[model samples]
Target: MQRRGLLLILSSPSGAGKSTLARRLMGWDPTIRFSVSATTRAPRPGEEDGREYYFRSRAQFEAMIADQQMLEHAEVFGNLYGSPRGPVEAAMAEGRDTLFDIDWQGGQQIRNSALGRDVVSVFVLPPSIAELDRRLRGRAQDSEEVIAGRMAKSRDEISHWAEYDYVLVNDDIDRSFKQLQTILEAERMRRDRQPALTDFVRGLNREFEQR
Candidate 1:
């Protein structure tokens, strides 16, 4: 049956494993496309345009916003970042889901956009604050100050958990991933997502009348 694609929005605190889960979901379904965001920040070494981000000048980024070309946008740490609307809509038209790994603010904007009806948002949470801190420290990728800042921000992020369609406490990666897969599968079967089902049911009704 022909099915319309959905936008899967995953949001969580810094160490809550949303990024990890997003990667797993993509691996499980290779056809899913990741939403590449546009950013005004200069690319670091080894980062390529369109792969890591769609690098744009601040003026160009603002122009996109002015023209209503961005699905969602935000200023973070003095840099502008947003998801371009064109590519996501195109993917949806082609029956390809787009995955978004963004924070709560971005998720909120996209969920409230014109494409809101097609959005399925999930929020990931840590089992405990101590576990969250442990996971961040275990990565050893940040300085003490940076880790502290993330921990502080995590509270605010967790506060928004009730806003999501589904919430997963990511205490176990494999278990959480299974739950995510279930959510996607169930959502795919929703009557609204599969428009072709209407015609199929109509045909059945006609056959019944003929019988």
Candidate 2:
């Protein structure tokens, strides 16, 4: 029997390189399906619906929340961001891993839901605070005041490192992504996590008795 996929949750502070890592990991592995979240925010230039996010209205977002349809959601900088429950379930049912590029609070919500056991969480970190600040400013999209606020938020995000099952310090992108890939590989093979493997173990007994 094929094993069900792991729900991989990769979280990090802003400018910690999670988005790059996620794209690289998904590109390297075909078995994983990246979970595109639903958002109530307007799309940026070049952003597409369903590719970037399922951009929704406040009413729709509120309705999803009211009906408990979202797997997890949070308000980031006054914008509503959340994961839809249906798409994740459909992907996992097909034995494909679901990648969630979200924060720790979102991870906590999923863990509290039925989907909790499917999750394997990884938290990414920057090499240093100075590097983090530099990376954020390198984007050049924000004002100095906005950049300062993000830096402050970064500290708060990093403080939750202990909540994750694994943590990776990203000094280098390629190396850190490889480390993340290795973690995914190991997680997929965990015995207790793969209940489907128990059937194979049972089959060994039949072969032994025949011998």
Candidate 3:
């Protein structure tokens, strides 16, 4: 049956393993397209322009927002980040599933848009608040000050867990990945997503009549 694609939205607090799980998912299925975001923030070291983000000047990004080119946009830490509506729609039209690593706010906006039905939101949670802090400290990529700031925001992020269709506690990466995969597989199997199923059922009916 011809199948339509899903817009998979994976969100979690800063220290959660959403990024790692996203990588594993893409590795599991190469056809899953990663939604590249547009950002007004300057690219970091070793980051490519279009590969990491579609880097834009503040003026350009604002222009896109004004023109309604962004599917979901938000400001964080004084930087503006958003997903472009055009590319996402194009990917959906081509039957390619797009994966988004966005926060709950962006998730809400996307799910409220015209393409809302195509979205499947998942929220990943840490096993515990203490464990969440531990994971953040383990990364060592951010300063202690930054970690503290993130910790303060963790509760806020976790509060919206129920908004997602699926909620996973990322206590163990392996198990979490398995659950994530199962969710995707099940969502893909939903009857509405398989547009060709109508024809297949009709064929079966005709064959039964001939018999």
Among all candidates shown, the one with the greatest TM-score:
1
The true-versus-predicted C-alpha distance at residue 120 of model 2, in Å, is: 1.0
The clash numbers for all candidates, in the given order, read 0, 0, 0
Tell me each candidate's RMSD, in Å, in order.
1.1, 1.8, 1.8
Cα-based lDDT at residue 200, candidate 2: 88
Least well predicted 10-residue stretch by lDDT in candidate 3: 87-96
Residue 33 error, candidate 1, Å: 0.8
lDDT of each: 0.95, 0.89, 0.92
TM value for model 3:
0.92
Write down the TM-score for model 1: 0.96
Candidate 2 vs 3: which has more lDDT? 3
Question: For residue 29, what is the lDDT in candidate 1?
Answer: 99
User: Local error of candidate 1 at 17, Å?
Assistant: 1.0
Pairwise TM-score winner, candidates 2 and 3: 3
Question: How are the candidates ranked when ordered by lDDT, highest leading?
Answer: 1, 3, 2
- Candidate closer to the true structure by TM-score (higher is better), 1 or 2: 1
Model 3, span 44-149: residue lDDT tens: 9999988899999999999999999999999988999999998887877777789999998999999999889999999999999999988888878788898878
